[model samples]
Target: MSSFARHRPAQPSLASVGPNKLTQQSLAKRLLFHSHPTDELPPIFLSETLPPELTAEVYDFIALALRAYINPWWTKITRYDKEFLPQVTHILVIVIRALELRIQRLNIPALVFHDIPTILSQHYADYRNALSKLSTSYASGGAASLPQLFSQMQPHTAILPDGKIDPEYFRQVFDYILRVCLPLEDHEAEAERIIVREVIVKVLLDDVLPKVTQPWFVQKTILDLLGPPAEGEYMGPLSAPPSSFSFHNLLIIILSVLQSFSGACIALIHAYKQAIITIKLVQHSPPYKSSTLPPQTGHTGPPPASPVADQSHTFVSPSSISTTTSTSSSTSSHPLQQWGSISAEPLTITQVGGNYAAPGLAMVSEVFSTRDRFSSNIFHIMLTMLSISITSFLDKLLPYLLLNTLCPAFILNITRLSKRTLFPNGYPGPQPQEPTLEEKAEIRARLVAWRGEGVLSYFLPLILGPRPSETLGAAVDPLSSAQCNTHLLVLLLDRVLMGLFPELADGLGNPSNS
Candidate 1:
């Protein structure tokens, strides 16, 4: 027998001792054996059917060995075969569970967190190397064995079982890795943490996303995790309820994706576009409509007169009305200024969307319902991505910008409506004052301009006419800002095109804008 096998640690008898009881003993022996500079490492016994305790121990040994004993040799290590990589994935399933459950009884060390990223980075590198070799070998081998070579090129059966990718599986893996890395966000460890994030992001964008049946679904799910919960509905993978801490972790991952991957801009934008359609469908679905509608008053005509109506009957000059409006407007233009000022400073997930803190970021307001924190986070993410896409990738994004801003339906969805207008079935909440004559005249002029623009312009009023939603927090109100920002972004894109390609800009203008 080989010297390595001659000194192999004997497996403890299962009848006399449980696997959990021997964890420290196993770790100590593995660490001692691997620490020697000249001793050959023992063969790793990895199998899909390995017991959970054995799997965890194997991974823990690999992790500790890398950190404590293998650093110098790892750079020169032979590349693992594709089959080996998938078995590594099986080992990871156990680590993922421990991290997810916050299990404290595991004999895993702190260094293991650091080592996990290192192992993943190396595994993917080997995977890529194997693919490169496979392609090269196939190219030179000729058509005699093309069918067999093609079969070899198919994604590993272990990773893509039944030729289908499970995006949630990857998501769980990613979430756990990032959650473990959160404590390393400080300056001293930030660089190392960033490297790990970049590696994971590269795999996500280049490898995983391209293979998925619907890449958009994966993107939407990630954003959904980072955002607030859906109203009257749970939002998550159904593994856990939405929480602030998880949202914060997810946000970090997303920010890393944006920073690391050049193609993420396009992917996220497409996801946002898909989100617009999905949310609109959900909002109009029977469940949302029924849940959000105010109680019936049984009267459809004009509202019954009250003492407030009696006060309104006392005539006030249009000039006085204009003066008072201007004064109030000049003093403050915030939609919720009457209620109170809101902080614009960056907020922790805890301070995001509600009075009570959960596990993630939320925004709340005393003036309006702060229930839809997910909607709020989604909006902020959309705005950040739009700004980045427009400013940085304008050339590639021009087509998207045109569709979002010029398409009447797209515009209508992004703009907020008055509470009464939006929930037409009934609205018992605060009602905004009626428009003054000047305001009415302005509206009419705007309508006329819209009509002059052409048939499509008729829909612009619905898009732009609604007052902002009364919801006060960012988590609660996202669409109003989206409407304004998207309009500006398209206009900016137009001007940039005008400078670069005047003919293109000329064709891009809306009739009203022209």
Candidate 2:
């Protein structure tokens, strides 16, 4: 037996087996009833198991579908051999169903109610026709039709077969149309205009008008949104009828309130002045006084005796004695006593007749001086308080009024203007008259004249300015000359492009078309 085994081919070991033998032995039981390799695996196997070549083909189909329907006009109707239409339709339907479910969950009413159904119904016939063509082409040496594959795709008995179209279904359809068809449509320009108009109207009605009525708040919010207004630009409301509330009206109201407060301040100042004047007049009035003196005895005896004895002498020299007696009597009489009393009493310089003496005037002057000083200080204090109060009131009130009233009104006005500009015929309206030829011509003429008078004089000077020379002897250096030429060329190009296509020109000259 050992000699026979050596002579015969050494029994083949399991280690020497090829892959074909291993496969046959290992898979033989699994492949018993199956003719193809794929028939043995689960139907819902992961795409990761797919061969690389098959994955690449699937990717190509997806890319082609995406690009082809991007513009509906670009669909390859002329090529009957292409079998991609049904596959694209299948993908679109799946996308639409997914979108419908999403919109239904979100509860977006506009898309559900207004837009979706219209889009789906309109595109449905075209989709069906494309699918039919793809299937017919596919049956004659092409890929299997989408419908056929779908029918074979593990019967979807679990899903309900109800045909009732949901509003959400339409929304999904519109979403798909926007994603796929809108880019491909030839009516993009018109569609864009319509969209812009709609957005403007919606914003005016919903956002802008409410803001206008509260001008102060609106302005602040707008500043926040758009940044500070440019210098010399309309930072406030536009002119309109007084009956129509605006930002300016709120400003006027604030000013009126300030004026009233100022009037109150003026009244207060007047009251203070009157009080000072009264106090001064009372201070200058003189005080009253009373006085007494002892009674005086008459100088009788000696005077009489001298008079009798010297009568004869007096008769002899009557003229001299008469004069002497008269002098003595006058000196000795109550006139002296009255003079003494008058001297003893205090002498007050009172205002006699209508005129005041210097002393009397002094009292008036001193009182008035005090009064003036007090009045001045009081007036200053009052003025300062008035200013502070007014400022404080305004600081508080202005913002409150602006936020609560002015901003909303201004926003409303702007909203109205926007509506007029966007949807002139949405409400009852007469068409606005076009500008007269004379007016148009006058405007044009004025513009042209203004431009001709040197709107660009500064620029011309810079361009024509003298260039730096490399050496005093050298004519312009080649480098400098070249730079000058380049500058001129760039300037010329800028002007030409701006004149021809102002919209296309940015800081850079027109961007390269390529």
Worst 10 residues of 1 by lDDT: 287-296
Clashes per model (N, Cα, C within 3 A): 16, 21
lDDT of 1: 0.31
- lDDT tens digits, residue span 1-514, model 2: 9898789976788989866567752121122212333333222112233244332233333333333222244354444423333333333333333322222222112111212222222222222333465546544555655333222221222111331112332232233233322222322344432332333334433343323323233223333553432343324666865697789989999999999999988988998998677545444432211112111111111112122112221111121113332222111111101222212222111111111122222222222222234443454445445645564333333223323342334534554554455345443234334447675444333322221112344432222223211111111111112212222222222222222221121212212310
Model 1 over residues 169-206: C-alpha lDDT tens digits?
A: 33433433443323222213433333344445444444
State each model's C-alpha RMSD to the native: 31.7, 52.4
What lDDT is reached at residue 399 by model 1? 22
Model 2 misplacement above 4 A? 1-389, 407-417, 427-514
lDDT of 2: 0.30
